[model samples]
Target: MQCPQIVEPEKSTQARRHALWSTCSPPHQRNSPMATTCPARARVPLTLQRSHVCQCVFIRSPARVGAVVSRAEASTAERRKTAVNMRTPRRRRHRSLTATAAATAAIAALSTSAVAPALASDQPPVNIVEMTPELTKKMQHEVDTFFAKHDLPGLSVAVVTPARAGSDPVITTFVAGTPTLGSSELVDATTQFELGSETKVFTADLLAYLVATDRVSLDDPVQLFAPAGVEVPEWTDPQTGATTAITLGDLATHQAGLLDAPPNLGAGCGADPGCENPRPGYTQTMLWDAFAQPCLNGQPCPMYQPGTDWLYSDWGFGLLGTILANVLDPVIETEPPAYQSALDQAFLDALGMSSTELEFHGDGRLATPYKADGTNAFHWDNTNAISGAGGLISDATDMGTWVAAHLGYVPSTAPIGVQAMADTLQPISDITMSCSIPDQCGPAHFQMGLGWELHHAATHDVGAAWAFKNGLTDGSSTDTALAPSLRVGVTTMYNKRLSDTDQGLPLAITLLKLLVADQPAPEPAPSAAPQAALAESGQPTAELIVPGMMAAGFVAIGLLLIIRRRGHGRRSTR
Candidate 1:
């Protein structure tokens, strides 16, 4: 069993970097037989467990001791299984060490026989399933399996696929569990869930409708649409002394450099952001007050150069929605305009989204919202001026139809005569996010479209793109994604609030990956260190690596046992 000693170079950086000997052999045999070709030249096909860090496998063979088989070389079946079964993370950001540990344990709980799949260089054409009875059952199965594993209150899933020849587009809906824990009432396709920020998509669509109708332009300054004598503050560069007015487009694309929420909200919440009733008390007058407070007297209202950076601002969208409302009818009184009703008459009703409302209907169909700890959560009512930002309550059916309209599937009853729907999806800003929280920034960056966030395929590489949005409220979480190229859309709604990683985005993206078989390889998720922008928009971080390390370890052990048995057989035959 004595192996030749391998001498180390005094300071060979390249050798050190490429050395696998440390783990490949005992201390006495620091030389990995992999460093050089084996004289035996036998391709023994050694298999090791998958490694999440590397996203590949190392083969230990008699002839080639350390050959690497990348994710691309692995079987497609394994790839599909891993993609479908990956654990969902609670948040959108990169995972923390504790979250990573929890994810690791979850993955370890999976059947030990499962193998981790690699990101294949060339993915097969996405298998877009047609909406059929059989597909409905399959989709139901996926939904059921997920609910069985999680302790959430309820879920409703909707998927729309391109129709077969001579048929309309196929639509399927799946509902699971009850609206509340231990409730006899069950969730259905029509069960309503708060849309959260997905309402931003609707708000953006409304803006597009106005633009298409020639009521306003994207480049028009916000002050132009504001009520007379109300000021929507603009950024004045102190260094250059040049003043730039915020535009409707800037607000829509989150480039307005506004606060995430207006300052009045802080004053209402006593500066504690986690307060449940922070926004319901906010009104149009408060919004106007926020707009008017900038650079007054000695108060400093510093804004980054508007249109220069991307920041998520509920305050900006609230302002944008208010402006759009004023476009419909100029606000003459001090009272808040009925913006939500105006929005419905203007477009939501036109789009046949009858189930969607800015306020709770007090009906049984609306699922009760629950916090993560299963406590009843205060329902958010955005009936005030800020309704456009996170106001709408919707169900799988209505939201699915809304998504269908985005993909040119608008029914005759609810037609978008102008090109406004398409305009809402045009990329307005390039998103480049930096991670300051260690291990919490994911590789997903976005291009801001009016109300939508766009996830494109690999960077600098041409492939399909998905327009998606994640919505969260105190009680509910929802995710919506659509691939226009494939004419496929998915919406996942949950009754109780889930962590960013554990929310519906992972499930929705997983379903998208299943239906869109040809989706490009996902961009590599960033590590704990500060990293550059995504090279390609891949699957969300939740889908790719969470279970990989644990599954790979199991796979490696199984492969070793097989290798040992085969070796004994060869010796006996010889």
Candidate 2:
């Protein structure tokens, strides 16, 4: 290395060359000397090259180093300036980040909140029940069996539970028979049948509605509302000689001493040669006049004192209906209209029972009334003055709506309580029947309510307690029953005019029992304090209850899972 002396280039020349090389050199090799030794042919044009390379090199070296130093200083100053800028508003920067995070979280929270209900909507609704395949099949089978056994031409039945807030009721329908005996038109749930005495229930309800609205008072004397100069027959107390007036309650409760049917209903009769009009021809006015007559001369008397006993009297109910019409006329602003017709539209229409009505039009949809012998030939007579007692025509679907309303399962148009309806369904009288003639009577105990019949000790052995009513006319037999204990209700409308001994009522009972066969026993009544203490002390109470058992089971399962997870965590740690 000491063999030759290496003279350093002059500062100006070195600087000049450095400048020239700095322009040509790649950024990575700018400091290397070998970058300058390229051939002239490989070099850039001399004009474009550095003029006076030695001088250029000498001038540019310090300038290049200074420029580098200046750049480094500027970069350091920029970094310091950035650091200062960052430190000056440290709290503000932190606050900004925190605010941004909070804003982002709030936005995310809002989005999540909005998305939850949408997701819930997307999911299937809860608390809804679909008819199980087994239930459907059983219902169908039962309906078919009934048709086959009864030799029905066509029949349709609709069973509905009370509707829930956001869910429709479980409506199970079966259509098995034809609408007409000859036409083979399939019957559907919309098929209409005369409701018969079932109309009495609606009429009674309307009367109750009027009473509820203060349109009429139950204790108001019927004579007050009776047509002008129409004297309502009165009953006199034998001891007091005081005239007893019949009240609206007497008529409604069937204690008005009215006859079961019109008096001398079949009076005008003669031999075929000298024929007279038969079938008691009593008009509404005539019935009212007869009611005005004294039981004996100059004394007001009734069969029994008002509200003394309950008798099944169509006349009593008829008078009640007439009074209801009079009371409702002024309030509804429809004077002298058919009271039954107005009641149907006001209450039933609002409830969405579009298929119900007070009259049957002979459209193809109306089911023909028949006799018990399955004879389609039957008279379709007007209900006359007693229309309110037995004139409504409805189908199973519409009846279900009415039942739901009675059960407080549907909102009522009139402000009446379920207790009021229940009161109407209570037993007001004891009806004893003789079994001498099977068609005429049977061994039955009937308790009469306002419009309901309480059947005690029914044939069925399921301990059936029912609020029932039956309607029998020339060609139609209709029955409706509600079993509150079992939470079941039924409506059976037969086109045929069936006797009390016919299969309609029995069939309805049997079907109702079957429908409720699987219902759980109702909850046991709460024990008395002593009984409760005994139960707590492990002594037998009246009932052994499983209170909160399901909830306890779920809690136990959750605890077990938690314990197992803890055990697993301990084992894994080990």
- Please, what are the lDDT tens digits per residue for candidate 2 over residues 128-232? 222334544565576677767766665555554322222223344455566567875666556777776677777777766665545677788988876667777
As a TM-score, model 2 comes out at 0.58
Per-residue CA lDDT of model 1 for 390-504, tens digit only, reads 9889877566556666776543333232225766777888867522222233444768788787878542232458877878888888888777777788899987887556644
At residue 312, candidate 1 shows an lDDT of: 73
RMSD of 2: 37.1
Please give the CA lDDT of all the candidate structures.
0.61, 0.51
Top TM-score prediction, candidate number: 1
Q: Report the poorest 10 consecutive residues by lDDT, candidate 2.
A: 50-59
Over 4 Å off, model 1 = 1-129, 132-138, 266-275, 292-302, 331-333, 411-419, 433-445, 459-463, 500-505, 518-574
